[model samples]
Target: MESGFGTRRRTRLFDDLLALFLAEGFSQFTLDDIAAALHCSKSTLYTLAASKDDLVRRVTVHFFKRATAAVETTLSRNDDPRERVAAYLTAVGAELAVASEVFMADLNAFPPAREVYEANTAAAATRVRQLIEEGVDAGAFRAVNASFAGDLIATMMVRIQQRDVGKATGLSDAEAYTELATLLTNGLRT
Candidate 1:
């Protein structure tokens, strides 16, 4: 097993790399850039990560782990499926709103990162479908095609968040959640 100091050092390096990646698109930066940004040498980075691709994978995994935790926290706050769905979307929107432009640009630049994002999208869609199914079973939502509707709504919400539509509409994250919840609930209501 790695020593505690080694683990801390690795964590710090990863955090620094993540911050840099979020600030500068992955493709825009070279190994030298990362090394210079972190005040370290290229050899040190090589020692820490096998290659740039490995670094990207590590960063993507780190991001997803943190995001998944946030989603779980939001889900835990409510027992009602409808409320859980709203909370989840709101959390997602907040995340997108705060995401750096560089991060979005970098995501587009990296094909592997894009693939990872797609996988996450599918997973999120499954979660949304489950919530919708639960709501339907509880008579909290209408009798509709839960899977299809869930995917559609999830996609739309992602687009809206990415576009920062809430800012244009002069709505806070909470307001956006309420509006989205209203829309979904109405569409699914008996």
Candidate 2:
């Protein structure tokens, strides 16, 4: 039973769904669970996606799309190359600030969402590489292998998303990200 909602309304619903998924994760929430949380009926959710997996994928796509846009928007606000690089990293960390352990665990456990996440990381790594180049041009970063450094940052981002990082280091995901940003920025400073 599809609801003939306006495009704005539908986008609003996706926003709510994305927020919930970020806070709680994908695997544990059934359609009924989401309906209850979102205060909407299952049929209304049907208007967004046909099935639970479809809904998860749709919401995950929405999440990543909005995240990339926001990161770009934020990065563009700074003119300084080093500031832009820092803003880029901080924006990525901001995306995960709401993600709890359960949310991350479920995201990694779900194959489709995990792939979306991995792709997002790869894209972010590309941005990091570009930022490193910009920083080098501006004489803010040493002109080493920026591509290699970006790869290292990407790998570190993946490891930070893992549960064991928090478990072993006694830092939350947000904390781990802040630490990573500090270490990377400090190491690259010229």
Candidate 3:
């Protein structure tokens, strides 16, 4: 059985690992490099994941899970449909702003990590769909096909996540999300 202190240490180490990955992409780090960077032993790092790729995937999951919770918390604070939609998008952007461009590029390049992002994007798209439906129901938005709009937004979001929008428009992911929120809210307004 693990002691409470052991659990806390592991949690702190995981937090540190995530911070490091967010600041500097994980693509270039070896197990030894990671241990050195985190001031932990190789065996200690192994406790987190069996391999570097596994650790990367785990950290990616942690990042998205935390971001999702924060976005939901932000959304809960707003009552108006328009504001709720805007808050959701803005909150997503805020959470993503912590990730460096290098980290994003690395994430896109890694298939396992990319899958996690794709799953989160799909979930977020569904959420946006529901928000649009709510707005239309509440008479705050124009009567349009909510599913279509949501699908369109999902496509744009995937493009943004894939770095295609960044390549084409010179807009960072966070900036692109902000633009999306503005355009979506304004277009939906009655």
Say which candidate scores most in TM-score.
3
Write the residue-wise lDDT of candidate 3 on 157-176 in tens digits: 99999999999999989898
What is the alpha-carbon lDDT for the whole of candidate 3? 0.93
Q: Rate residue 144 of model 2 by lDDT.
A: 70
Indicate the residue-level lDDT of 27 in model 2: 89
Best candidate according to lDDT: 3
Q: Please provide, for model 1 over 1-190, each residue's C-alpha lDDT reduced to its tens digit, 9 standing for 90 to 100.
A: 8899988987888878877776665777788888889999988788777988877877777776667688778788889765767777666655544446667656755777766766765677688788889888988877878878887877755554343654478664435656776677667766
Residue-level lDDT tens digits of model 2 in 133-177: 889988988777887998898887777655567778988767776
RMSD of 3: 1.2
Which is the winner by TM-score between candidate 1 and candidate 2? 2
TM-score of each: 0.79, 0.88, 0.96
Give the Cα lDDT of each candidate.
0.71, 0.83, 0.93
Q: What is the lDDT of residue 173 in candidate 3?
A: 90
lDDT for 40 (candidate 1): 91
Clashing pairs in 2: none
**Model 3 spans > 4 angstroms off:** 1-4
Ordered list by TM-score, greatest first: 3, 2, 1
Clashes of each: 1, 0, 0
Off by over 4 Å in 1: 154-182
Evaluate model 3: give its TM-score.
Answer: 0.96
Worst 10 residues of 2 by lDDT: 157-166
